[model samples]
Target chain A: MTMKKIVLMALAACLALGTTGVYASQADDINALRHYFKKKFPTVPFKEFANGSYALSADKRINWESMRDFPPFEDHVAKGEALWNKKFKNGNSFATCLGNDVTKVRNRFPHWNAKDKKVETLEGNIVACQKANGEKPFGLKKGNIAYLSAYIASQANGQKVNVVVPDDKDAQAAYEAGKQFFYAKRGQLNLSCADCHVYSAGMYARGNLLSPVMGHTTHFPVWRGKWAKKKGDGFGTLHRRYGGCNKQVRAKPFKAQGKEYSNMEFFHASMSNGLTIDAPDYRE
Target chain B: MKKMTLKVALLAAMMATSGFAVAMDEDSYRAEHKAATEALNKAKKVGGEWRDSRWKKSTAVKVDGKKMSYLHAAEAYAAKGDYKNAMKYAGIAKFEGEMGYQQAMDQKNAGPRH
Candidate 1:
C-alpha cells in the first residue's frame, strides 16, 4: 500500500477507537445509575425512577415578567435604583464609570477584558467601578451589591446579551477555559456538565427537565424555589448559579465570586449572547 | 390438626427471624464484607489519584453496583485524596440515597409478602 493510504488507515483506526471509548463510558454511566436505583429500591422499576430523579418538573420553568412584581427581589431592585442614584464616597455615582446612562449599562457589560485575559461579567465590572472610585468593593456574593447587580442586569431585560469575544489569544484562552470548566466532569456521580445539560437535557431528573445550557443566562435574578424560603423572594445571580451547578454535579462548589466562577459566568453568559434577559423568573 | 398447627407456628417463627436477620446492623455486616466491595464503594465517593480535576470523580463510576451506597464511594474517594468528589458523593448518599432507602423500606413493610 502507498504511504498515504497507510496514514489514512491509521487515522481511521484512531477515530474508531475514540468513538468506542466514548460509547463505553456512556454505557457504563447508565449501568451504574441503574444499579444505584435498583439497590436503593429493588422493587422500583429502574427505567421509570432513573429519569424521574433528574428530570425537570413542570414547576421549574420560568415565567419572567410575573416574577418582577415579587419582593425582596423587587425590593432589592428598588434598593438598587436607590443605590444607582446614590453617589459614591468620592461624590460620584456609577454613572461616572462611563458617560452612558446608567439604565443602559447592563446591555454593554460582561465585555472582554484584554488585561485580565477573560470576559468580565457585569457584576465584576460594577465592582471595578466601585474600586476605581476608591469605594469599598461590594462582596460579590452578599449584601446590597448582589441585589443591585441583579437589578442593573434586569434593566437590560429586553435587550440582548452582546458580549463579544475578541479574536485575541487572551479572550480566546478565557473562552476555552470557560468551556473546559463547563464540560469537565466532577462529583461522585463522575458526571460532566455536558452529561446532563447537553446529553440528557429534556430528560427528567427528579421531576425537573435538564434545561439545555444554550440560553440559560438569558434570565437573571431568577427566583429559585430552593432559595425562596431563605431570601424571601430571593434572587440568584450568575455566580450563585454557577455555584449551584457545581453543587448539583457534586463538585466542591466554588466561592460565589471567585475567578473560576467568573470565568464560568463569562462563558455561560456569552453562550446566551443573542438572547434577551428574562430576570427574576421562578424555578424549582 | 396439632401437627399442622405446630408446622404453621414454626413457619411463622422462621419468617419473623428472617426479617430480623436481614435487618441486623448494616454497618457491622458491611465492615465484615469483602474488601473489594468496600474499596469500590470508597473509590466511588472519592475519586482515585487522577490529577485532572475533570477525572476527580472517575473512580466513582466503578461503584455502579446497586449494593454500594454513595457513602462507600465517598469513603473510597476520600481515602484517595479526592475530597471534593468524596464530599459530593457523601452528601448524595446521606440525602438522596438515604431517602430512597427509607422509601423502599416503607414500601416493603406495606407490601404483602408470600
Candidate 2:
C-alpha cells in the first residue's frame, strides 16, 4: 500500500478503537451504578412493586383532628404565644425584635446568609434574633426556642417555604452536602435515606408506607399516633428527624441542632421550597 | 426468474429479523409477567391468611364445638403438609375465634415453613 493510504487506514483504525473503548467505559459505569443501587436497596423489588403500589397498608393514614386537640406542643404553642406577647427581661418581646408583627416575620425566615453563604433555618434565625437583642438563645431541644420557633413557623401555616441559596460556590457546596447526606448510606441497615424515601416510598416496612420525604418538612410539630399520649406535640423537627434517621441506620444519633443535621435540614427544607407549610400534622 | 429470486431474498431477510424480534418480545413479556404473578401470589397468600384469621376472631360466638376447633385442626393439618385442609380449617377457625385470638390464628395460618 502507498504510505499515505497506510497512514489514513491506521488513523481510522485508531479512531474506531478509541470510540469502542469510550463506549465500553460508559457501559461499565452504568452497570456499576445499577449494581450499587441493587446491593444497597436489596429489599426493594422494583419490578414486583411497580411505582406507587409498593406500600399500601390499612392503618398508616393519620387522623388530623385527633392531633390538634391535645397537649405538650399545644401547651408549648400557648407558651410561645405568651412569649410573643410578653415583654422580655429588657421590656422587649420577640415581637419588638421584628416590628411587633410575629405573623409576617416567620415567613421571612430561613433566609440565605450572605456571609455564611448557606441557607440558615428558622431556628438559626431565632438564635440570631435572641443574640441581637442581648438574650440567651433557647435550646434547640425540647425547650422554649424550639417551641416558640415551631409556633412562629406555624403562624406562616399557609405560607410557602422560600429559602434562597445565593448563586455562589459556598451556597452550591452547602446544597450538595445536604443532598449527599440524604443519599449517603448510614446505620446498621446500610441503607441511605433514598432507599426508603425514594426507592421504597409508598411501600410497607412492617406496617407503614414509607412516605416520600419530598414536601415532608411542610408538616412540622407533627402529632405522631404511636406517641399519641404526648398529644399535639411536635414529633419531628429537622434535628429530631435527623436523630431518628440515625437511629434507623444504627448509628448514634447526632446532637440536636448540630452542623451535620443543620446542613441536612437546610437541604431538606430547600427541597420543599415552594410547598405550603403543613405544620402540626398527624402521623402513625 | 431474477425478480423471483429478489423477492425470495427480501422475504428471507424480513422473516429473519421479524422472527428474532418476536421471540425477544415474547421472552421479555414472559419474564415480566412471571415476576409480577409471583409477587401477586405471595401478597395474596399472606393477605388471605390475615383476613381468614380476622374473620374467625370476629365471629367466635357462632361455633359450639368442644371438639378441636377449626383453628386447632388447621394447625394439625398444616403440620402434615396438607395445605388444602389446612387452608379450609384456618378459614373456619378464623370465623370462630375470639377478637384477641385473631393474631394467634394468623400466626398459625402462616404455616410452619414461612
Candidate 3:
C-alpha cells in the first residue's frame, strides 16, 4: 500500500475506535465499581455497605445502633408523610400528582430521562409533581422537601437502588458525564467525589470516618449530628450534603438541583444498585 | 526608673522595625499589598481559594477564610494610611494563608477511604 493510503487507513481505524468507545454501557460501569469495592472490603457483606461508616467500623456501629434506637429522623419522617398526603388548594393531594403507591417510587429515580435529555432526582420530581398540581414546590435543600423525601424514602425501606442508563444516546451520555464528574477533581482543593468516596473510603479526615462508596447511595436525607445543631432544621437532602462537602474542600458548590448535581446523583445511585434503601440514616 | 526607660526604648525600637511605630509611605503599602496577594496565590495553589475565606467550615485551615478577609482589611487600612495596621493584617493574612496551603498540600487527596 502507498504511505498515504496506510496513514489514511490508520486514521480511519482510530476514529472508528474512538466513536465506538463513546457508548460505555451502564451495566459494565456498575459491575466494575461493585467489583472494585467488593475486592477492597472483602469481609464486609455487600448489603451491609448501605449502613455506611458503620459497616466499616465496629465502634461507630455501636453508636449507630444507639442512635437508631431513638431515631432522630422520626419527626422528619412524620412531617414528610403529612406533606406527602396534604392536598393542594385545588383539593388534589400530592398523591394525585405522583400517582398511586409511592413505596417503590424512590427506586426509580436518578433515572435517565431520554425525553428531557436529563437525569432527574426524586426531589426534583417531587417539586415537579407539586408544580404540576398547582401547589408551590419546596426548595431542594431542607424544610418540607427534606421531610417529604425522607418520608418517601422511608416507604421504600427495602427497595433496592435501581438507577438505570437506558440504551438511548442521551441517556448514556448523561451517565458518562456523571461518571466523569465523579472522578474529575475540581475546586481549589482539587479533590473529586471519587477521591473521598472511592479512593479514600474508610479513612479519617477532620475527625470523621469516611464510608465506602458501595453503600453511599442507599442512604439519603440523613440526620447528620453536626447539621442537627442548627436551630429548626436537622435533616438534609443528598444534594445539600454535596454542597457542604464542596464547601469543605474550599470549592464553590453548584446549586442543589442543578444539572451537574442531578447527573452526579444518577451516577452515585447507580453505584449502589441492589443495596436496600436506608434513608433517614444517621451520620456525624 | 532606669529599667523602665530601657524597656520603653526597646519597645520603640521593636515597633519601628516591625513598621508599627511609624506611618508607612505609598511604596511600603504597595509592597505589603503585593506580598499579601502573592502569599494568597501561593496558598490557593496548594488548595485554597478566595472562596475558602467564606467557607468557614473548611477543614483545610480554620484561619484560611479569616486570613483571606484580613487581606481585604489590610487593603482598607493601607487605603486609610494606617500602614501599621495594614502591615500587621497583611502579615497575618500571609501567615494564615500559607498555613492553609500547607495543610491542603499535606492532606492532598487524603480522605476517609485512604
True contacts kept of each: 0.00, 0.00, 0.14
Instruction: Give the per-residue lDDT of model 3 (tens digit) for A52-146.
Output: 88999999999999999999899899999998888788888867756579796777788877677899888998988888877778988998999
**Alpha-carbon error at B60 in model 3, in Å?**
11
Q: What is the C-alpha lDDT of each candidate?
A: 0.57, 0.55, 0.76
The C-alpha stretches of model 1 lying farther than 4 A from their native spots are A1-72, A231-233, B1-114
Q: State residue B104's C-alpha deviation in candidate 2, in Å.
A: 43
Docking class of 1: incorrect
User: Once model 2 is optimally superposed onto the true structure by TM-score, how far is the C-alpha of residue A279 displaced, in angstroms?
Assistant: 1.5
Worst 10 residues of 1 chain A by lDDT: A46-55
What does candidate 2's lDDT look like per residue over B1-114, in tens digits?
A: 999999999999999998887666555444533443343334333221222222222222223342353455555555565555555665544332332133222332221010
| Candidate 3 backbone collisions, by pair | A200-B112, A200-B113, A200-B114, A201-B113, A203-B112, A203-B113, B53-B65
Error of 2 at A58 (Å): 7.2
* Candidate 1 C-alpha lDDT tens digits along B62-102: 54352334556766666665556665665544444333233
Cα shift from native, residue B113, model 2 (Å): 36
DockQ of 2: 0.01
> Model 1 — TM-score against the truth?
0.56
TM-score, predicted candidate 3 vs. hidden true structure = 0.72
Off by over 4 Å in 3: A1-22, B1-50, B53-114
